[model samples]
Target: MLAWLLQRQRPVPIIQMLCGPSGEKILGQLRVNSHLREHLRTIYAAPCGVDVTWIQEYLDGLRIPLLTEAQSEELEGEVSLDDLMEALGRMVSRKAPGPDGLPVEFYRAYPTVILPQLVQCTERCNTVAKSICEEGQLTCHAAHGASAIYRHALRRLLHTRKRARLDPDGSADNVLNLK
Candidate 1:
């Protein structure tokens, strides 16, 4: 089966790919970088005419409470190896690989080897994040911004007693019940 799978195949002619005029035009356009840049800019640019005052206000409110000395210290606390391991265990093995082409399975399969390095990396990231927060430089309000900014430092310390399967009330208690 492996031998059959590894068998080499004949390459298709380039002329076949550019058989049509539209295909030729597309091939020509692919050589230019402007289209790629324009596409990315269009996709990533902030929405025009939208009032971002509310977002700024919300962030400002969050910063005032979090910037307290005690809170900042808590945020800068050492990462727990147990919690990191638990989170790693929860990761789905079949999930997509990151940019380095390493899937969650790679870490899960060799926790002893990878966990230490990962813990160090996560600690460094936390330190940088804390510094950024302290410097008041975390200003991005993109739709898919960093999760560190969204998760409150206080909330991390709270231990969820039970994982409630369902809650109809949608109260603060119910929200806190979530993992």
Candidate 2:
């Protein structure tokens, strides 16, 4: 009850997904990044993900510290940013909205190329596709295109890069330079 009350004071920051019951409203507010927003909206329209109730039930037996440790182990090694970009590219393209703001059937239309890309990091959807390619692992384009997952990944990457003093010009060896 205390947790619930605390949560009530600050709602979960929901990503405005496409294709749920509130799709129209979500779409309408997505004008700044129209193309990207449309795609996200459609992702929700498709029925996906595991059941929340079942997931919570499973969590009951797990201890919080153990879960955190397991998560830490899971991300033991670092994968390339390009891989992440590729994954997101395919995800957004297939799951993203079309010009009409409707969901584009990524799997059905472009199955061969998109499947492998889904598991890798993606960077094709946003303004950073070309740069991510040229900059090798780090690029402003990649940073800009990074989805929520990438943001989390970038945070860690930036912290580590800072500690290493990788870039003298504050560009982190040109890995994350917008200018």
Candidate 3:
């Protein structure tokens, strides 16, 4: 598995244009490499501690939209064989396979065998998801008034929002800065 993953992984190219800590354009190979390494370390390597007051404050300032009961039910609906077949049909062919090296063409050519297994796997996942929800390990749209049950989910959503805002083609505009 590790070999398969390593074979697929590609190294990121060095940034040719980046501003240094002094707000000047970084130049030269050695300086760029050193500055990039230091910048990444400063951003990611934090002293480990459990001060979550800022996280609570951040989450408290945002409003997560509530889903209607009907919408929630639709999202939780069972996956039908026909639905799976349609989705598979829409998939592009000749793509690289996963670690198992079983391609979409293989599944398309052997639907009778693949469809049933796919349905079974999906059902198993749904069962595990429901179990997690029941055990209070995860919270869904159905658990609206719950206390901190879905804080991690909210945090992820917030991170996604921040990324979208900071994306090159996107405008931060009215979006509050999140860190």
Candidate 4:
């Protein structure tokens, strides 16, 4: 995975251009290689609705630009980044920050809310792993992985937020303070 990460990072942007226009029929979704396109398509193939659109916007946040709308569509069959940006732009107009200055997406995807939920799910899986082992499993793995997942999710959302990045609700050490 480490080697793959280094080699395959560039294709992320390529996939975006492919998906926006076509919705789900994007071809060559990954630029460096198409090996992971199927897996990505599977992950994004969930029921089409608000949550899916939200994730598409978040993933769109990760795109790196390249201009080939027609050529790309000819090669692939869609405009991914365009659709994602459209969805995100729609969300922008809908947001009216409440008294707390938080958009509705905050309540839907808050770090505080998301982290505890992740921890609870991770803890259960770790407990099962511990029981299956002669020696107990380490809780730290689940803790660390959950924190990383939340951090990555937050970064994606924050990336989409642009200038209006989510504010830290606590101290500088709040990154790990999922509670």
Pick the lDDT winner.
3
Worst 10 residues of 1 by lDDT: 158-167
Q: Candidate 3 has which clashing residue pairs, if any?
A: none
- 43-156 per-residue lDDT for model 1 (tens digits): 789578879999998987783312334433444345566655766666667774345678888878888887687567656666666566667777433211343432333233
Every model's TM-score: 0.38, 0.20, 0.45, 0.18
lDDT at 140, model 2: 56
Query: How does residue 37 of candidate 4 score in lDDT?
Result: 58
Q: What is the C-alpha RMSD of each candidate to the true structure, in Å?
A: 9.0, 21.7, 13.5, 23.5
lDDT of 4: 0.44
Q: What would you estimate as the lDDT of candidate 2?
A: 0.46
Q: C-alpha displacement of 125 in model 3, angstroms?
A: 2.2
Model 4 spans with C-alpha error above 4 angstroms: 1-91, 95-139, 160-179
Evaluate residue 108 in candidate 2 and report its C-alpha lDDT on the 0 to 100 scale. 44
RMSD of 1: 9.0
In order of lDDT, best first, we have 3, 1, 2, 4
> How many residue pairs clash per model?
0, 21, 0, 8
Best by TM-score: 3
Off by over 4 Å in 2: 1-67, 75-104, 122-148, 151-179
Q: Give the whole-model CA lDDT for all candidates, comma-separated.
A: 0.51, 0.46, 0.58, 0.44
TM-score of 4: 0.18
